[model samples]
Target: MKTVYIGTYPPRRCGIGTFTQNLLQAMSGKDDSPKSKKGFFVVAMNDFDQEYDYPEEVGFTIRQECQRDYQEAAEYINLSGADCCILEHEFGIFGGRNGVYILSLLHRLKIPLIVTLHTVLKTPSYEQKEILQRICRTANRVVVMSHHAVEFLEDIYDVPKEKIAYIEHGVPDYKFLQQEAKKEFKLDKRKVLLTFGFVSRNKGIETAIKALPEVVKKHPEVLYVVLGKTHPHVLHYVGEEYRNYLIQLVSELHLENNVVFIDKFASQPELFKYLYAADIYLTPYLNEAQITSGTLSYAVGVGCPVVSTPYWHAVELLADDRGILFDFSNHAQLADILIDLLDHPEKRLRLSRNAYEYGREITWPKIGAKYNNLVKEVTAEQLKIPRKKSIPFDIKILPPFSLAHVKRLTDHTGIIQHTKFGIPNLKEGYCLDDNARALIMALMAYKETKSQKALEFCPVYLSFIYYMQNDDGTFHNFLNFDRTFVEEQGSEDSFGRAIWALGYMLDNAPNDSYSQIGKYMLDKSVPVFDNLRSVRSIANVILGISYYLKNNMGDDVMIERLRKLTAFLVEEYRQNSHADWKWYEILFAYDNGLLPLAMLHAADILKDEEVRRIAFESMQFLSDITLKEGYLSIIGNEKWYHREDTRSDFAQQPVDAMCMVLMFYQAYKMTDNIDYLKKLFASFMWFLGENDLRLSLYNYETEGCFDGLEREGISRNQGAESTLAYLISYLVVLEAHKNYYSKYWQQNQTEDLTSNE
Candidate 1:
């Protein structure tokens, strides 16, 4: 389809210019056939007496402060045989008050129009509101990045909800590796804190500089890197006044050694590299109404943990532990958060992971696809073509399993609890929780690919389990940087997880040596199940026992232990199973699927029909609540689903989605019902943009899944647990699809032979 984009195209030093160029590049990349390539023409916006070495794609140039240029461009577009025109709208980019000059072009445009709004002010002036309203009325579709912008447009600007489409600000798909970039820049040892973009008072760089004194008190070796030159408009008018003020402040605070300024506009790769080198990214912008910040997007994209004032974009992107948000201009709170994260390296690592994982959906390819789809919809509507009712299932090709981030989190001893972005934070020390899950992930990878690399991790993880185990068979969860155990007997969940890992290793160990190690740990941990009181812990133990019985059948002691655990679970279910509430607990929280899944496994091993019935019934109840509207509507971790209270719809986790996939697969296996298989695919598709937000949780580039889905957006953190959950679910889904397709082929062959006979 032929399309024209009106914007400040690149060769111009503006965020909107970069966005327009990126969008065109992505669209062109997606279209492989050069002969039938979609015409992506650009009408560049320029300032008075300003000139750029425009590329061949530019069809026309409109002076920003010129009124007649807009009408001329519109007339040219009308005669150009373009199917649709997409205007990248920013008030300052166009001429006249509130950019009302764009109305002249909109009035004359004959083709379908889609206007992508870069900013939506919550409280717009009368003229500002009217101009936007006119644009909304004139355009076939209005695009916004944040949901808050959509709300503001609809409520405050009187724009209809149907007219607005929420597409996230585009971020480049960069790998989550920071240490190598740090080494390249000779910043391998320093704690690199960064804020990049055009220097402006609204950017609130002064606040970050103010916060640095407190931050440097704890982290004396901290380096605050301020990249990017002053904003072009700020440079043209103010002559670096704000930049001078910031430099003076750094000197006055005795932070000359800490602050380093690179006064130039960084290219995309350079920007990403700088972001990678950063331990924490800061965006202390003063404008709460600011809806989009490309710097923030890039920082989160490269997996930098952010500490920002809660602007509209930051508030949406940094929700759910993805980043820490301080109030606007609150340098003290910013300092406190920075110090706290620096002191507790584990939390910083977690924040970085969250940001990177969440950033996957907002990357250019995904955003471009969303834009393309919207354009198609607009064109189809204009041409009176019947569009498909359901979105086509575009199965994302999963990347080959890489131990890149996983190995980053792991040291010579064990996997650390967190990372600062993708760099391991050794100060957080080691944890059995991650090592246990990592063990299963490695084994699963080895089982599927039979790679020696996957097997190499097995011993490290197995040894970690051995390290955490006590003489009486209990395991410690946390280990400090000095290799000291923090707790005597770890939480019930940790012990149960260690057992689960051991059981998996025993069932699917690559060799006899691994199996022997697994068997010893399994035996040592089996007797500890009698002490587990938490339903999830007991449920986890039951799963481990089921795995054990799968390999070594007719073990009477293991059978009795399994039976006792099953009885306890059944009693719990009976007590809690009311008319509508059919769960083990009053609230449906994390790992809720494990309870029913454990029952399903127990029923198979024990051959108990009652237990099987309860398992199916309870699973059905859980599915009924979670699989609403044919999507995985997870019970929110923030405020879980209580018996009498409303179900919190967000903070839905990858673990929960992974658990549901397992439960559905088991249910389908036991019943041979195709309906269960359908649910399995749907739940699996939750990671692939089949969820409520229509955003993918899986990052194909990083091979990591986002931590959770929040009310505002997906959690950007690509932590160990969430990444493992996606890999596990992905492998299972791959197996199911393989088996399914294989069976169809065999059945079809039989039918052909029978028909010939």
Candidate 2:
């Protein structure tokens, strides 16, 4: 397809200009068919007194301050036989207040138009808001880099959800060569912290400079590198005032030995080199409404551990231990975080790995394909042809296995309880609840990838489990920071959960030592299962017993215990389940799927067909309740569903979605029905924004999932349980895809042989 891009093109030192150039290059690389020889074209935007040596791809040009230039460019594009036009929109890049002059070109354009918004203001002035609304009304599709931007446009600008597409800001695929670059840059011993981009007042370089003195006090060889020259507009208006002020601040703080300035705009190669040489990247921008950040994207792409103020872009990118975030202009917090990271190279390296893995999805090549796909979809919509919605099914796009957040949440003793907005809350101490889940998740991850990192976590978590066990075979759920148990006997749920985790490790442990430890723990916990009162706790113990029975099948004691627990669960269902109520309880609560799932496991282990039928029936009933409108509508925790009360629909947890995936997969296996498999994937897609809010719970940049989905938006906190839930669900989907593809391949091969015969 012939596509044209309109934006500020290169030789102009603008972020949008570089973005348009990179996007066009990537798109052209993808358009390799012989029939499309010309590749993509660009209609470069220029200022009144500025001009670039235009490349061969430039089909036209528009003077930003000239209104008539826009109309002329549109007419030229119409006559140029291009199939569609992509407008790389930035307010200041276009002429007129809020860039309203671009409306003239958009109005006159005969071909289809796709507008990629570079800046989405959360709170806009009257003219800015009106211009954006008009653009949305005029364009076939609007592209934004962040989910936050999508929400702002839909909620504040009244843009239709269908018209907006969320595409991440593109970054170059830079290699990670820190040691080589550091040696080349003659900074072999220095810990380089860098902030690169045009030096505008809003860039917040002073904040980093202010924080550097304290950082330098800890590490004498610390270097704060401020790269890139003053912005062209800033230069034209103020003449290097911001740069000079930052320099003065560095001198005043007595940080001259620790601060260096590279006062020239770096080329792409030089930028990559500097990024590779740096230890940590910093972006302390002042604007909270700032929507897109190319510098931050580049830093992340190269895998530099980042320390950024919580701007809109930073908040989305630095989440979930991908990097460290401090309050805006809070230099003390910044210094503390920086020093802590520098003091601990292992933590810095972990953060870098997470950032790099996350950046793979947003590289220019991947982003180019997303843009191309959007263009095709918009083109089809413009021509009024029916087209299927694009569903992301590529397992490769899933985040890589990184234990950065997991490690961050854990101490030598155990994983901490709740985090205060992604930061580990040391005051809350450790919890048996999270540590149990952590051990299971770590074991599963190790089984799948055989990752040494995953294996390292096993001993720590196992030790925590052993430490929490009381003499009576009960467990303490909570412990203070001082390592003293806070409760005499933990809740039944905690005890049962610990049993479940132990059983899982017993069944899946890679080595004999782990197996033995797991067996010891399971043996201790089996006697207490009969005393559990909560239905959920009993259900959890049943699952544990089922795992134990898998290996030690002839153990009559364990088998009898499993049978008794199964009887109790069945009795609960008989009392609570009726014509309309198909659950074991009057109200559906957290981890509801585990109840039915345990029944399925027990039915299989005991060879009881009646119990098996009941398991399927109840699971199907729950499925019907959740899978509405072909998407997973998890019962919200804000106010759960009751027998006679309205079903609440906000604050849906990741645990719920995760439970459905496991349950549906099990059902698919038991019935050999494809419908269950379809449900499995559909429910998993809830994390990918195939739900009510249409916002993704998964953050590709951090390899972390947000805490939960809410009525208005998603929870920004990426805690342990949420991250583990997403990882578990992702692993299930990956395994299912592998098996399905392998089977399909074999079937095809067999069919070919039959056809040949």
Candidate 3:
């Protein structure tokens, strides 16, 4: 089975890149199985603004920080006919918080995936842990280099043990002549101690430099060679400060003659020759947190006598006298160990012998064979699990309808406005806008699935609306948990949303008691309609009046109220709109599609041709801006699209997606246009990861949705408004599938037959 490798690739100057290149080489020409020809290629990751002349084997290249590139790369991999994908996962190599942008690619992949983790921190940040856990969930098998990482995955990350495969870092399979390599480097007369790989402050090179002076005092011919360039990232930002400091330290210690710096990224042959030339390998890493050190692995694989700090990898690799370890930053201890090993030729030979014996098991050929078998196994297992039909309109991919998260957010009072993660953050108290949304969501949930829990909460949310309304027909937006209003009056937006909830109840209420209560609240709010100046407020009031008229079509007073609201919305569009901008406002802000959604509702109820025309035109305008990419890119709240300014691409709110879904569904319902139905599905998919960042905002684990899509990643906050928006969109999509999709197709079939006749 052919495999596509996703990671940084040569000649990118990244350790992960080198590892991937080596793995690809090892696995090449090894596929003899009949299932398919075993082969490998790469999907190289390019750092920001840095490009490479990649080889033909690199099927695709993904710019690290460009989010769309990841999705496109996944598409390329899927179409490449690769049976399985192996990803080299490192936190810093990919884009977004904790390298979350990789998730988009991983999620879209159709084949089995195996991820080899390069770093596994014991105490990961919130985003880091989330990203890793999500990665583990997506991968068929997770590979880690060290046993400590396997335990960390199980104990800390809660990954299933069965899903983890421990694979040691592979080393080059080549023989080296130490004496000849030493002579070639002109270090044959000296005792050579070497440290290689990208140099950075964290490597503790100064500790080794300080220890060298003491070692040189006893063995005057001792030489310490520092190899590899400064870490590219550190060099880019800090500009060789650490490297300069190390040079100065060597000079001040009067050990300049004993220390030499080789600042180049060595090829494998060159690195292996240097490894054999050294009597000892020094890894003075300052921390014990390193789960895997490729340089250290290479040193051991070459059978060099190793002197290193007790980093996690060193401790495990040197447990059985394979190498010696010293305390971190304790140069004196390192010095003593070095002097003893240099003096005792037999002891050094024994360490080398033990390391070589162990290294044989982890040579590149053996490690490559293990990975090849794993790929075959994962492929066979993947074939056993029935695949979902690859149809865009399949509703089978939708999560089962549930109100568990909504119930978690709601209380006896009402659904809480905000949550920290999935837990309700009562400190934020409650808001009328969210409660109004919660009421509509609950009604739709009950209407679609007849969920008893949804019907049970309808009264609870309606009660919140009742408690927030003032005697004067205005409503207080905020309320503390103490059940007291915190404001005298709410924004026009909140009041309009309250009307929307009440009107929706009048139309789709489960019983007469709810209808009476909704009618009572909506009738009292009608007097405040004339005062609604915000275009959003007028639009929302129109939707409420239209829904109300769905039940009481002959209510002339309500019809007049709807006409006045529609007129107000139309006048706003007439004043602000031009040949270029077909919107009801000067700029695209939050809930941008609401205006057209309201217009559609008014046009359907009024049966006015001009109103219907404008409604479809504005809906198309919104669709052009948001769905031009064939997926919803909600107008971001961060510096929204001004009349002539570029549109900000992040901080995409869920409410905008929900509004588009509603508006398009309404348009499809009126016109039976299949295009609108497709757009509606795409808008709903924004929650499921088809947006700019391509990260799903809906949290299936908690059944709650994240607040929005921000520049860094999905916002961690799962607030009521966002969750309600997702649930409402989900219900609407289901409604379209049930009431429109099959019928539309059947109607098309009938039209085809009629034309033939």
Candidate 4:
């Protein structure tokens, strides 16, 4: 009995073994045939004690043995061959450096050895070069499926030209194999492009994605089917990194509607079914090999029109009469091909039929006869023996980070705000730059209208920004966007915004339990306080607000730290700080009110004259940053990021509503300066209500947040948030009502707004 093993057998579960088993079954069949000499085959160098049924037809046998020694096994198999021996040689499955043992065994067989080169190396390694050279010296015949490969090896290696035999990879014959059905839509309507095969790094799935815009315009239905996952061995060189890179590129390009990545394995029959569904088959591969294309063969075998890179092997297949050979280096050219192919339907059918005609001639019986001829010739020859050993195999499996300690992880959060996605924690695959404005919009809407949907975005935004805060409060740039949903913690400014949002949410929310949770989490953190600008500013800000809300100052250290932070704000915003006063003003104004509240608490506790000075100075910046227009101007150049028509759209201008809110309350408490209070009140109403209450709802947009306008008769600006901002705007007008019963407001909307409260 002779055993030939291919895939991982018995104990190991692998795809290649499954393919090999099917191949064996096709050769052996259900009933034993006297004409066939095929027997139990374990083609593997190392055999597991366990045995797995081939599931091939029947009457088949497997001769198994432990390959303690490869060269010895080769000699034993050769001596016992009683006929011939075949070895399946692929650079990936067999050990690169030790792969020569397969050839050495062929040498020992001398009776006749036919080696099937499973893979043709486009980028052959040093060990691969050495093995190919040794195989050249030993094997009586080499079987290659590609003609280009015959020429390539002839030029690259010292192998005899006549010694190599070419037999195309086989595909099962099926109906619809030769038919190119009229597209559901007009042939020119859309491009239903398809990609099926192992998805590996160099396979360049992204190239196809980048070309989608052009394809879609020509054929709107240019749907892409990324039919299968990758070969296990392919990941060793490329790793799972490329898979992620491709996914992000797809998202960034907004191809979610056109591209469908089916990360599943398909059988031979299923593969054909998928191909038949496509308008054009795409193989935008970066690498070209002379050897073989299992996928291309399948596509062509089923008469699918293709658009592929002009690799040496691809040239051979299509040079005769197949499909278009394009430059793999140019992305636009590849996309253009797809566009052209989708536009020309009859042309595609003509080429597809021609390729399938070629495929049909490649029957297993003919291929087996080639093998028989090689074996006959090899057995007739005399040869010397060589010694070698068995090979090892391994798989790539990333260790899982079980979220078993989710609470343990969340426990590290400074304030248990909410679940954040696509924010500061990078949300893995979600792009922060893409969502920053959206994030801000979501938060502002949450604050203004208090909509459930808007408020719900709070946890998401907080989680997005907070996950970046490590134990030590530092941030990373990248995170596992897939396996790990949240990734790198980014810049300080990003964190600061997140921190401010968290504080604002914590301060105003009616939820007391969450407030307590925030205080606790902050307390348990890695004791990060006024250390760095990014870390300290935000940390102290949270603590100051937390102490005020909880009415609990744990220790004097925190109180002192808060004072120092207030002092830093004061010094940072000195009248001559730089740029415009507004930049410093926004930060100062933001810190001013909270710091004053902190200072007020300290004044009651420490009785420090310095604390009183800082509190007073903090409140003073509001007046300094105010413009003559009764509104606080943005910091720096107002024209920096605005359209001419969109006046008062200061890119860095200070926010008038917030400044007025702070100043009006302060003036009311400070003295009988009713004028200051009145001014603050008028500014709030005029500035906020001037836009027709436009800024009220945050003018929601398509970016999944309240960012821009609601002009399409769509009341995007209405929600929990619109209600909140309106509520605040209404409060100011109410306060000024007692002083001035402005006839203009009453003549129109003012009376109704006033009555709203």
How many residue pairs clash in all the candidates, one count each?
Answer: 7, 0, 0, 41
lDDT of all predictions: 0.83, 0.83, 0.89, 0.49
Instruction: Mark the 10 consecutive residues where model 3 has the least summed lDDT.
Output: 29-38
Lowest-sum lDDT 10-residue window in model 2 = 30-39
**Runs off by more than 4 Å, candidate 4:** 1-40, 45-76, 79-82, 96-104, 107-110, 120-126, 177-191, 234-239, 380-757
In model 3, how large is the Cα lDDT of residue 125?
Answer: 71
Which candidate number would show the highest TM-score if scored against the true structure? 3
Q: Which model scores highest in lDDT?
A: 3
- Model 3 TM-score on a 0 to 1 scale: 0.77
Worst 10 residues of 4 by lDDT: 391-400
lDDT of 1: 0.83
Q: What tens digits encode model 2's per-residue C-alpha lDDT throughout 101-186? A: 78767867777889999888887864467567768877899999888999998899999999889988888876747788888888
The 10 consecutive residues of candidate 1 with the worst lDDT sum are 390-399
Alpha carbon deviation, residue 129, candidate 1 (Å): 27
| Model 1 agreement with the true structure over 37-91: per-residue lDDT tens digits | 3488899999766999988788999997666687799889999999889999998
